[model samples]
Target: MGEEMPLSRIAAAVGTPVYVYSQAALVERAAAYVQAAQQTAARCLVCFAVKANGNPALLRLLGEQGLGADLTSGGELFLAQFAGIPPHRLLFSGVGKTSAEIQQALQAGIRALHVESWAEMERIAGIAQTLQMAAPVAVRLNPDVAADTHPAIHTGGRQHKFGVNAQAARQMLLAAADHPWLSPVGLAAHIGSQIRELAPFRQATAALLRLAADLEAVGCRLQYLDVGGGLGLDSISQAAPRPAEWVAAVGEPVAQAGYELVLEPGRSLVGDAGILLTRVEYVKEEGGKWFVVVDAGMNDFLRPALYGGEHPIWPVALRSGRQRESRADHTWRVEVVGPVCESGDTLARDYELPPVAAGDLLAVMQAGAYGYAMSSNYNGRLRPPEVLISGAAYQIIRQRQTMTHLLG
Candidate 1:
């Protein structure tokens, strides 16, 4: 935990509203997935989703731990490479990749490109032909399996603009057989994110396996099946599926189908591994309601405002020897907000906290995933720095944006 390193020390050194990640946590989280896959009947390739937190340091750490990189765009491909993730360990995914992005992936010779639609497949094939290369392809199947998570994060249902239908995927593969530049080597499916239950994953896997069986029947056997990641983490409870449990629940079926398994875990591995540290700038009362405004705004961490997600906020630098008692005594209800000039810039609403005052630091927990990755420079607020803490030592992984950065 960053607190063990005295987050205040890092804040003092690097300033407030910074992301603090534990190297121990990141390595342990990644090892959990590897250990789980080893226990499974099939070989598993764990691709760390780049869209979650593309910090080069984080990506490099995971890569050193034997995790591959799952990229969404050409920029991510470059990040993966810069992080020293081998070309063979890289997987390109997403629905809106441009023609140039596809060309870059092919030129780089990534392990595979998880094709989202038939049109994208056509584009990749055309680019591969132009480059005189055989593009490794995986058609992402939209199983129509609905996850009961937030609607915005859902990707598998037919209505979503993600993967193609099972029939369409099969047709695409058949068509790809005629294209010399395209190699249909795998099938992929991502149902949704922050999924608390396993039924949806099971249903999606069943659909993929059935399609795999049909493909085999048509002499189009898939070498791998990418069970796209959506394993959820409970921000409040600090609860999530154990790696072994997750692998058994989702990887068992794919293993039984005789296809190598690929998982693109973004949140489950890192969601609870980091926290956003912010200093309470002011505490005010207006309209008989308490507002605790912090230095960090939506520009630093946007999940709370964007997805209506809530992260447990804790006061840093607790009173010595009375932390628990102090927490128990201070039960004032307050609204956690940022200085961003927008009504929707609230972090947590109707939250109970201790007697937090100006200059007191607050750590937003379970923000390792979408927190900083989705942050923006809206309202001219500069983004925060990111610090990686290991035991009693810490280092600034990303520097806080400067005022001149906005001009650029």
Candidate 2:
């Protein structure tokens, strides 16, 4: 919606199945989060979760806006730095960290490594000892709080293989405080992603504060509380929490406790800032059902198939001769599908839209976050290009994978 060029023009210029991201949306969303944190907390770091979308151009743009990075792997760390995000602004976090990745983060002198287990802490300690460097650490505590989101993305509960329990976290932090190579700099917890309500965050923050109090009693003071992010995007029926509301939910208590706040917002920041431009390849009818098939597949955009994600699709331009159709038309009931081999590649089932035919252009909304980040070379399909739009101008940040490149 923020783009100056028409969707048809973009489709024609870049070909179908290209990702188009709005620079204005990215800036606006980032500013909102930073402003909220500044207003609520005395000290805060609003880190963009790099796992959501790691395009170099997008990362560079975000870095220029004064946002830090929440990295989950060595590649992400490298990309963040490559984008001009300084080491002090990068925080590495993940459940499983290779010895090499730990060493890499330590050598890079990142802000902190959010440790998820005692074994990981020991590993970090070993790596730091070898490097003769003090590794900044944050224990990711599993608050056992349930979030109302897709189970595939859930991470905070005890059943999930995410963070350690509060007891284990306390023990790890205390041990880190005593260790020579590890510096216990922060306490952290991430319940899950795409969380829509504030109640679960409130519960998790309360638990973090209680744990911080116990640690402080023993002279173990933390510099910040890393509340991992999962703020959800707006749904058809329910509205997600705004960045300010989410910041307040977790920031207020941490600020009152005299600790800095760290948030790893992933989907919420970039989710609504992008769209997937695709072209309709065919319209077929089978078993008394209509199907609108597009060129994009699960290998290109996996959210709909992997997580049952329901991204709204709209025609880029209505037929020149046809009038605007009403929703009551039964002929519009159709299943929007992709060319992937699996049946799960269906993007939307029983979706209502105006009559669409082959050669029509469609835009899939709200795909900025996990769309391209999770794509693969499955079935040997080439990944699509990525375009960044800023007002009237647009640039192709990532070129489409060529067959020569893929084979080479």
Q: Which candidate has the highest TM-score of all?
A: 2
Evaluate all candidate structures by whole-model CA lDDT and list the values in order.
0.87, 0.90
Tell me the tens digit of each residue's lDDT in model 2 across 1-408: 566878788788989899999999999999999999999998999899999999999999899888999999999999999999988888988899999999889999999999998889989999899889999999999999988888998888989988899999999999999999999999888888878899999999999999999999999999999888999988755789888999998999999999999999989999999999888899888998888999999899999898888888888875666543433463588899999889998988898877877889988998999999998888888999999988888899999998876785
Q: Give lDDT tens digits, candidate 1, residues 169-283.
A: 9999887776788888899898988887888988988898999999899899888888889988875644666656777887998998788988899999998899999998988
Give the residue spans of candidate 1 off by over 4 A: 237-239, 318-329
Q: What is candidate 1's local distance difference test score?
A: 0.87
Q: How well does candidate 1 score on lDDT at residue 167?
A: 90
Q: Per-residue lDDT for 210 in model 1?
A: 91
User: TM-score per candidate, in order?
Assistant: 0.96, 0.97
Model 2 clash pairs are none
